[model samples]
Target: MKIILSTLNAKYVHHALALRYLSKSVPDARVMAFTINHTVESVCAELYKKITTDTLLGFSVYIWNVEMTLRVLARLKKVAPQLKILLGGPEVSYDPFETLTANTFVDYVIYGEGENTFKALCNANDCVSLHSIEGLAFRQDGQVIVNPPRPLIQDLDTIPSPYTSAELAAFEGKMLYYETSRGCPFTCSYCLSSTTHGVRFFSLDRVLADLRAMLDHRVGQVKFVDRTFNCSNVRTKAIVTFLIQNAAQTNFHFEIAAHLMDDALLALLKSAPTGLFQLEIGVQSTHAKTIQAIHRQTDFEKIATHVKALRQADNMHLHLDVIAGLPYEDYEAFQKTFNDVYALKPHALQLGFLKLLKGAAIRDFEGYTYCDCAPYEVLATPWLTHAQLLALKRMEDMVE
Candidate 1:
């Protein structure tokens, strides 16, 4: 059986780390990554040439590229009806039945962590074997049957590091996504990570070894996909310390909770070379009520203090994020949020609109409506009107 793992990245500089993990599990699988810039006709044409009778094509879907991916697959299926297509990633994981119902050409959907499930699918010779695989969803007798969710991988070390000497060389001078952990400590209602519980970490030894490989190859930048890089102070410090001691031209980026920073961590960061570290802090809203409504835990005062401290260093890049259209946050409240975060003088301030993503807790809240499409950006709410959100979108353009 021939397996091909693919995804349309948001940009040419971005690579799909999820595809790499799945490919590692199924060593025979080939990875074909593309960017959203590619036209659907062109991508489908390229993929169609690789399909055969026994080939299985897997797509790692995201809000940014779900439509384009579906278009490409829809065309490919018309040309090769025997071709098997599998869908995974957060976009389809939560609501597999709906995805399958709408796109009958897609043969399977892996709802959760996909390594074990994907490998099982690759090894399965017939329909009976697929039914036994946990975390799998497939059509049986004209109805989508979503199997029970798979247990989270406890020994993360078992998931082989996707990086190899040759792969590292290929990834040089581009943004690479790496992960030392999975899940998040906080349950932010707007985020899909909130649906899962607890944070899982790969062994420190495993993480350091991977980082060492990237540094050795002189990769340009590595972005940690961990939901909260500072969830564990010890782990954060250890990783930071390692990066500092093994300083290189390679830059590392992490999405961290600013309030989690302490005097010791700040001091450790200050000692690192200038521009070696970049931190992105998400302060979705400054309003206490808004934060509570979203089930997000944050202390803006502490966050402000830490952000100011980090700014004072004048070494690393600091990017702050604030979301408009959050619950109970009217235009005036959002203005306060923007102004509050702006006053900190972050190197970059991102103004984002709320996205009621599928499977996110925010969808359960009443008095809110979002677009019924990919990205599902907020349309209107009791607090913010569509016109106000549009104005915010213009403001975001100017801010960028």
Candidate 2:
């Protein structure tokens, strides 16, 4: 069996890791993974030229984007009808019903965590009892069936490293990406990370081992995909200290909760090697009402102080984010947020429009208006009109 797992771009490194873990559980399954640059059409054309029709037996294709999945499925059906297409990740998982029912191209949709479900599907000869499979959705007997959710993977150390030493070598002296944990502790309405109510950490020993492996591969830089790297101060300190001790080899980056930082963590980060660490802090908005509405409660003063401290250290590269189209934030309010976050002088200021993803609290609110397009992103809320959304989008482009 041959399985191909892919990302829309190089940025979605975590998806590759998850698929790699799934690939390990299936014996004799040759996995071919690639990062598609732009459109699905381009990707399929390239695949058609590379892979011949005779080679598509017991093959599985997994993709992140709906359009990409559909395009690949259409081509595969015409050329190799036996190939199975499995859809997962945030883009497809957001609205599996519409994606499954509307598009006949997708054979199965893996909801929530995909590692176990993917492994099961790969190893099974017949998928009739798909309902018995946890964390999966598929069409059975002309009806769409959704299985019960699976428990989160508690033992992160049990999973093998996604990249082999040789595979990691491809990224040597280039961009490196890895994840230290699975879920997020915060409940920010606009984020998919909030779907998981709490945090889960990988084994400290396993993490250190992965770091050592990356170092051996001569990986120049590593980015941690954890939503909030500092949710556990003890774990955060341990990882930071380990990196600092081995600063000559690995330079790690993290996305953190700025307001959650205390004096102890700051002291450690302050002394860490310069150019060895980076932090991305999500300051979604500065307005109190907007913060409350979005269910993100943080002390702005504390965040400001902590950011200032990190910036003063001249060691950590800082990045801040703000969203323009929140429930209660008006244009003026958004301006204030931009100015306040920009004042921190972050290396990059990411201004994003609100996206009402599936299973998010904001999606339940009937007060918001949405765009009807391929992406199906949110347009505006009752608090902000459609025109304001256009303005914000333009502003974001200009600022970014």
Candidate 3:
């Protein structure tokens, strides 16, 4: 029962689209994806030369590779003590029994949205079919058993396309993650998509036949992982007027909500073409009490009048973001939220620093202080200090 699927990616052109939707519902699962620049003894000596002891292996954890995927599954279960770990996204899907009681060599996790609980746990074989697999979380006699969560998959075109044609030749120069949508009309309390609630969609003829099969494999970039991708202005002008009428050189990143732009989607993204669209937005703090203490529903003057009308229509690629230590932001109110997002002249600005993740809603807010592990960042807050978050990390290293 091999079933492998993995993830570590923080670079090398990033690709694990949820291990290609859990390898299209476990069709003899085997994915592998690695990146946090490898080491953990070279990814457990290449997964101990392709696993055994009845394999299982799954991973896909987050918060930038959950502490190197728990030190590469605690050194691959101390060199394969009958191999069979497992864990799933959103950093162990919000505490699956405190992630199997502090990772006892994680024998299972598969919380929310893991393609029908990892294809009913690779077609379960015993323990009374793992107690009827519903977003499982394992261990028994020594108790852990999390079950009962697997709901959110309302026919997202019955989850399939991980772009076949042998996965678009393993997506040549990487960057090709696409998703027509999935929950986030706005809950924004330092997002984990605000502990999931609404939005779903996948049919606009299954998103223009999955962007006409990644613009007929011209795939240089696609990146829509939809946290908001314009939260539906008729599917953002029919997917940006079908990627400006069938994207020629691909290029298409998203993450939008710039006060929900319009004026006919900024005149169809000011008639695209110059580096065909990029966007990104997230102005995390212009400090109206740190955007009402992070329930962030922005309007920063209509995001500075639609990022100064898409930077004077210099043809797309905006990128703005902010975040430095929230809840009434300090250090002189984050320098006026970084000079009001650096006077919106963004072609890219970022400067982020607040992380407090693991089931976010601002980690139940109250005088912050973080880094208890895997990117729980903040480190000082009764109105910011830790030497002003190390002088906002040396002003984010001189604004990169």
Best by lDDT: 1
Off by over 4 Å in 3: 1-20, 27-88, 91-94, 99-108, 111-120, 128-136, 139-142, 145-212, 216-222, 225-251, 254-275, 281-313, 324-333, 346-355, 359-380, 384-400
- TM per candidate comes to 0.98, 0.90, 0.36
- Give the alpha-carbon lDDT of every model: 0.92, 0.74, 0.84
Candidate 2 lDDT for residue 398: 79
lDDT over C-alpha atoms for residue 337 of model 2: 91
Candidate 2 residue pairs that clash: none
RMSD of 1: 0.9
Q: Which whole-number lDDT from 0 to 100 does residue 2 have in model 2? A: 57
Runs in model 1 lying further than 4 Å from the true structure: none
* lDDT at position 81, candidate 2: 62
Backbone clashes counted, model 2? 0
Please give the lDDT score for candidate 3. 0.84
lDDT of 1 by residue, 1-400 (tens): 7888999999988888898899899999999999999999889888888998989999999999999999999999999999999999999988998999999999999999999999998998888887899999998878898888899999999999988789999877777999999999999999999999999999999999999999999999999999999999888999999999999899999999988888889889877899899999999899989998888988999999988887888899999999998999999998999999999999999999889999888888898888889899999999999998899999999989
Per-residue lDDT of model 2, residues 1-400, tens digit only:
5555544544434335565666665544455554544566666665555454333222222332545556666776676565566777777676677768987756777777777777777666666656678888877777777778878888877766767777788877766668889898888877778877777778899889988888788787788878888989988899888888887755777888888987999999999888888888889899999899888968889999999888888887888888777878887888899999999888888988776666678877777777554344667777777887787788778777
